[model samples]
Target: MGAAQGDDQDEWSFLFGMLMDDATKRGLAHDELYFLSDELLRFSLAYQGYEPLLEAVADGELSRLRFMHEIWRAMPEHFYVDLALKLGAELLAARQ
Candidate 1:
């Protein structure tokens, strides 16, 4: 990968780590977080529109929470519901 691409990936990784930390605090299981983070990475890679937002987050110009909010807003409702259900199921399973 080019230096810029590598930089973006590093930034993305940093942002993903922040998100995973937040999700862990909210009680998301490791497996669920893994799947969610993977999905998010895929989404960001496939969508160029999110590059600017990711760049902003990486540059420290935007809060991670705001980055999440923007991503959530952009995600389809059905997609969000599916991930939510999967996460909830994992949480319930973990509790048992």
Candidate 2:
């Protein structure tokens, strides 16, 4: 597969894993999980720059529950411009 296609697959995996982690922790029923996933998709899009969070439902990078938790913990309700700028650098470094 091409790099772009691979990246899309990875993103999908990650999003799905996150949804499952949240659903399991909250003891969500199947229908509830579907509803909650929609809410989370909005938040994930605005926070992570990923539209349609389902695209990352299969992301390999987000394998463990810890990864999902960490991502949530790292985000705040509102971003501070200065802090975000600094954290952007840190994020780039961490990704490497």
Candidate 3:
């Protein structure tokens, strides 16, 4: 956790807040909205990939960012772009 990492986290928070606001404006039921958020959290956890991804990273067969993007590949484009725009900044910072 460095300054830029913290900043990226803040940006992600802002973006998700904006997205949830949009969801409310669209009249999504509270439970539906919650489910949407939960799905994202679940997908994020899937991207972290229990053990295989860690092994891949250790073996140099994959980068963590690439593994994360593989999860993003399963998402809707709009959701993916919204997350990726911020997440990419985080991953890029992590790489450096």
Q: Per-residue CA lDDT of candidate 3, range 8-79, in tens?
A: 434444555555566568887433454334345456555433445445645868543443434333433455
- Clashing residue pairs found in predicted model 1: none
Q: What is the alpha-carbon lDDT for the whole of candidate 2?
A: 0.50
Top-lDDT candidate index = 1
Q: TM per model?
A: 0.30, 0.29, 0.29
Question: TM-score rank, highest first?
Answer: 1, 3, 2
Candidate 3 regions with alpha-carbon error over 4 angstroms = 1-7, 30-96
TM-score of 1: 0.30
Candidate 2's C-alpha runs over 4 A off are 1-7, 35-96
Q: How well does model 3 score by local distance difference test?
A: 0.51
Best by TM-score: 1
* lDDT values for all models: 0.58, 0.50, 0.51
Q: Which lDDT value does model 2 have at 78?
A: 49
The parts of candidate 1 lying over 4 Å away from their true place are: 1-49, 75-96
